[model samples]
Target chain A: MKHWLRIEAVCASLAIRSRMAYRLDFSLSFIGMFLAHLALPIYIVLLYGVSAGFGEWSIGDMLLLTGTIQLARGATSMIMSGLIWHTNERVQQGTFDLLLLAPVNALGHLLNRSIDFEDSGLFLSGMLVFIIAVVISGITWWQALLLALLASFAIMFFASLYILFAAITVRYISTLRLFEFQDIAAQYAQFPLHIYPSLLATLFITLIPLAVVGYIPVGVVTGHLPMIMLGSLIFPVLFLGFSVWYWHNTLTHYTSAGG
Target chain B: MDIITITDLSKTFKVPKRKEGLKSAIQSVFRRQYETKHAVKNVTFRVRSGEIVGLLGPNGAGKSTIIKALTGILSPTSGEIRVLGFEPFSQRKDYVRHIGALFGQKSQLWWDIPPADSFTLSQHLYEIPKQEFERRKNDLVEKLGIQDIIHKPARNLSLGERMKCEFVMALLHRPKLVFLDEPTIGLDVFAKQAIREFITYTNKEYGTTYILTTHDMDDIEHLAHRVIVISGGEKVFDDSFAALRKIAGVTKHVRVVTQKKVVLPKKGVRGVMHISPYEAQFVLDREILGIRDLVKAIAQKTEIIDLTITDPPVETIIAQLYQAKA
Candidate 1:
């Protein structure tokens, strides 16, 4: 418990420092993100006006999904995206060797020591949507809150997956396709998962498991998924564990490129 | 007892050969070839507690490779490395607890944060107790004279100031074994001297065992009691400074400036050679020259304005050693 607290304190301090280093950039990014979030609901409202229900769901249900996904994505972006960039820079500059020699868990060091604050705006925007959606959709208070927490964990799991992919790229140095795939995945997450075919919907739930981020949990909360789909919550924990394990093994194979 | 021991350590890397030009680049992407490069080959050494040893070598001489292997950052192709009685590569966490490493070209501190913050982070990373961390940090900061700059961001500090802070950061945990790779690179003379003094004081005062790699011969001369020189992945020379000079046939160069421009005799005097007009220099050949006679001849000159003598540089001696081994 003490070690975990220390990690959290250190990570938080690093994030705060990084944010303060570029105050103007931080402010600009936050404002831009807030405006972007407001723009998204407007776009969705226009679409709903032109068309009837987005694939078996009302406009209110779609708004709830949008809020959940935005919140999860915002939290992950704020916390874990910085780690991906840090891993890449460390590998290229050969600074990763310094961390490897420290008497600490390498994955813990990398994941906790770096963070980005611009994503906080996204989180806030998502929270606003979440509150509005809960009021309009009439979700049970306890169940809705529980799913919301689960959605956050799922976001962290996906972020860890991104970090793992970046670490692998350090070794391979040629598998840039993973990045392109992530960009496409981001676009997919922007909309409701039901619009996609059943095969892809299953793929998103199982293979990538992005559905758990906001879609599945919100779907379960809104009565779209039966209690059987509560099993999806297990995916985040299992996937996070797998990512942590892969990170340790892959780090051992790190041959620092230069002196 | 030896704090670090390695046997037949070797590391080989597979480097992909990429073709240049737009045409060849596209063609080679599908049919890529790789060549194996041996970074460290059959290299072995041991460092006892409280010894400051220098790993001397030129660029691409596998010095950094060997350091990385010892630190458990890179697994050797084949070898045994025991640091603090544990296999470094297998028991990295346990082994690394007794070690601290600093690469001069890298900054372990967060660039945008104060050094004090980085130090706190390190304290937690190493699991140092609160009281112990404070005491050690205060002592190190005081000793290194970085109290004034500890709160400033690392990127805003000068090179020397940043390096001083880096040194303090590495040593705050008080590890028994320290590896410093080019710790004084790009620093001015004053900063370099400060670092050298600190390393010497730490080795003597705290009995810290250090394995330092540097291109600066002066650093080796000042701090290293023993040096291990490697070339082309092979250990070329490993011995004391005096012994290395003797075995490499390296000697001092003495330039004697005469009061008048006297032409040296056609038949050169024993133990002395006329290297330039009016400038007579002596190479002490154990076969023919004696130091007393050389000095007596220079004294006989009308007047000697100033004379200087210096040993051949370590770089030259190292180059010659490599050539001889080749």
Candidate 2:
């Protein structure tokens, strides 16, 4: 375990150095992401105002939902989502051989080296809105703590799904473009799930599960969801378990087929 | 002790068949058809503790597949493989630390990061002691002449420079066994020589066992003591370097210089390559005709000035083997 931590630190440091090399580009992208996240709540407020709110979900609820999604996306991207984007290229070029040969767990090493510091701006912006939404919604400090815990769990849960995406890419090299589906799922979190059609909502809660990542946390904070729903917490554990198992099973079939 | 052992090993891949046009691409996805490819078929071989074995084969002959299986990148479909007392696929995390591999076509170095940074990452992954890592890093950098390029990002480095760093990184762990796949594929003569020297140094100084696969026969000729030839996913030949030439029926060129003008012996000679009053050269298949007999016959005609025997080039011998199989 100590060795794994050391390896993770090395991977993170390498990623930081590489990003530091493009300071100007990193700064520009950070500003763009910050502006994009900052403007998101305004758009939600305008939409909710014109629509006179969404199914008892006021503008404050929308803000909380959007902020939490950004928080979850930023956290996931900072650590593991980049591997989803890189999996296809690495498998195609056969460069993933290095990861397989590393002394560390292949999945952990891949996730570790992929840390993206550019997401920090978005994460900070989301945190600021999250705090404001908590105050305006008059949630207790304990509930805020619960929201934070659920958000962290959601990050792991989403990261596991992306791992499954990456594994699929490894198994079928042609399916690399399917990685965009991850972003599309996260995009679903910006709005209230009940506003969508019932079928879509069912899919979101079960098969797709994007709403479960952030929406449920907001629901719990606003008294719209029972505290017993914390049992839903076990779902991420199961998802992560399945994801890890599927990844290893698919890896055994990695043909290293391409030239 | 044997560093590697394999028996009846095979690997098969289910390659999804592709059809032309947009409609077929969509339709095939729903009703997928696969073709089973036997990449390695019931092949088997072993290597002792400190031996360098060259894996020779034509394209698609499964040389790379075997290397991948041994290096724990791909699991075998059937049969058993034990390397360094571990099943490479099942015990990958523990087994890989004892081995190193370099694919000439694919680099391990992070393209956007300096080679030094990659080296540091490797140091952490391998968990080498700080003092030991620094010592080996400095020694290999100087020996491979990569000190100047080690700090530059891998993308900016030339192919040869990147390859050198690749070697440095693979060796940094000081693995007991190493697999080198086409390690000198696109290198200049000087770069190729440097790599050959590194292999020699590592093998001698560290007793590192090696499994080298290359289409470059020069690499096999320079680095490997034994050669294993696989053709069509089967072991066609496995023997020492000198024995490979003989197995391929490659002839030896014999030139004899006489003190005075003499008549050349015509019997038992496959081809009289060159002829002069005092000197003659013949290409002789030693299997059919013995070198000692020919020299005795030549000396009986006139006092021999000098005698030289040269084996055919390894490239020609391998080409002949491939052609015969084709």
**Model 2 chain A worst lDDT window (10 residues):** A174-183
The model with the greatest DockQ is 1
> What overall lDDT goes with each candidate model?
0.79, 0.83
Write model 1 residue lDDT over A138-255, tens digit each, in one string. Answer: 7777866886877766686667677777678667764546656654665676666878899999887887777777677777777787777768767777887787778778876778
lDDT (0-100) at residue A150 of candidate 2? 81
**Candidate 2, A157-187: lDDT as tens digits:** 7788788988998887757566677667778
Index of the highest-TM-score prediction: 1
List, residue by residue over B1-326, the lDDT tens digit for candidate 1: 88888999999988888778998788777887889999999988888999899998888889999999988888889988988888888788778888889999998888988898888878887888999999999988888888899999888999999999998889888889999999999999899998998999899899998999988767877889898997888888898866665666635566777877633332223356765556777644432444565566656755667676655555677777867668
Candidate 2 residue lDDT tens string, B176-288: 99999999988988999999999999999999999999877668778898999887778888888777765577477778888888556666676675577877777877666
Q: Place model 1 in a CAPRI quality band.
A: medium
Extract clashing residue pairs from model 1. Answer: none
- Model 2 residue runs over 4 Å out of place are A48-51, A197-203, B18-27, B249-319, B322-326
